[model samples]
Target: MTEETRRKAALVGAFERGAATYEQLGVDFFGPPGVELVHRAGVRSGQRVLDVGCGRGAVLVPAARAVGATGRVVGIDLAPTMVELTRAEVRAAGLSQVQVELGDAESPALPPGEFDVVLGGFVVFLLSDPAAALRGYRRLLCPDGRIGMTTFASQDPRFTEAMQMLVGYLPADRRRSPTSEHDALFATAESTAVLLRETGYRDVHVTDAAFESRFRDVEHWSAWIWSHGARSLLEQIPARRLPEALAEVTPVVERARAVAGDLVFTTTVRFAVAVSPG
Candidate 1:
């Protein structure tokens, strides 16, 4: 399969597996940090908002509430399962103004110049062509619209260390040589700034926030990994080695927990916001 096809398959498989419990696990993992980023973006009533890569409506639902009944929120995700999950969530919440569609962030299949605001959480780094995606988003906005995105910052030593401990068990080819995915994309502020400027966004600002999360224990961490795409790595290991892999990673989890206490772990995220030229 082509690289693009492979990435799409991987994303589909990951979200499909996570969908059943995404609302709970996703909120537990990302809700607070994402909410803070959206809150900082200052979503107001009567604004039409577009949520790109709206995984399970984690950001879209809250954003709909923030925008009130007078506004509308549209959520789009590449994965059909993710879109379905988010749609169900919007229904369960009794939110009439929120809609979820299966669509690509790189080339959102929406009418031009409709949205007053675009919000993306932990999405920019995942796009194969982030600049092109931003350019597309710029066109979707109503000239003066603003975009807000959240991504990892600083490559938290604790998180990196945890991921590194798992690398040994993964297929050699699958091992990520880069320390962090975010670094692979926006390694420097200047690079990110340049990309934003080139994409025709102005008044760009990047800021940071940190939050803590707790797992009951190593078992909980293991479950989280298995449920969220780490299972692919486990599949590469021999059945006999699976237990060893889990055992080996237990200490890493313990270390992260000890370092972070009952919180289990702490991570700092960077949020970038830019305004489309009027």
Candidate 2:
């Protein structure tokens, strides 16, 4: 496999192992924002929708509900475990309009010109070939179909502070080559817009929103890290250095809580919506 493919495999495997905790954590981190974004997209009854990287069906379920009984929602993800979790949720929720499948966003296993709306949350940055993925999504849409995507606007200051401390404690090489840093992909809005334009999407709109979350204590931050795949960055480090890294991050977390007051951490998220011209 190519290096990019291998990295994606590792990333998907890590998320699969963390799926249960991810679902639990996602209820707070991703659920509400996803709903709000879809609502903003103004889905109507009988509009066909596709949810790319529909992890645990957070976005898909709501889209299905919005579309009513006449419409359909198809969710695609790279991880089999994610697909299973999404399917189980759909069954339990009794949402017949929603279905889940295992597939890559770069080359979704979907027929062209099928969907009226295509949406996903926090998935754009995760794609290895985001431009190619967007081009593929464009093909899957009907004439004048719209796409909505959500991603981090900038690293949350609190999260970045904690990460900086942890990296400081790691060996120099590991710190410099950290897996969690995707410097090339999500660094700026201009770059993201350029990518979307290059992929053939037009009338792109981007907006930023902030949310505040509270972690009871440092342990909560630690748990969040493990549950959100940040722990994978520590996997290659020597076991002896793990404690030191965690220790370094603890003070940063504590400082953030103090600055936040009531232990609330703030994150800034950006959403982009674009339409494919007929």
Which candidate wins on lDDT? 2
Write one digit per residue (lDDT tens) for candidate 1, span 122-210: 77777777888999999899988999888777644655676677677766786763224446457766667677888999999877877
Each model's C-alpha lDDT? 0.76, 0.77
Over the stretch 1-278, how does candidate 2's per-residue lDDT look in tens digits?
Answer: 88776777767777777676774752267777688778877778999999998887768888998999999999988878888988997989899988898888878888899999999888867777677788888889999898888888766676887777666665676565424455565566776676677788888887788876667777776777766556556555578987877887777677766654545677777777888873
C-alpha lDDT of candidate 1 relative to the true structure: 0.76
Q: Estimate the overall C-alpha local distance difference test score of candidate 2.
A: 0.77
Query: Model 1 off-target regions past 4 Å?
Result: 177-184, 229-240, 258-263
TM-scores, all models, native as reference = 0.90, 0.90
Off by over 4 Å in 2: 169-185, 258-262
C-alpha positional error of residue 65 in candidate 1 after TM-score superposition, expressed in Å: 0.8
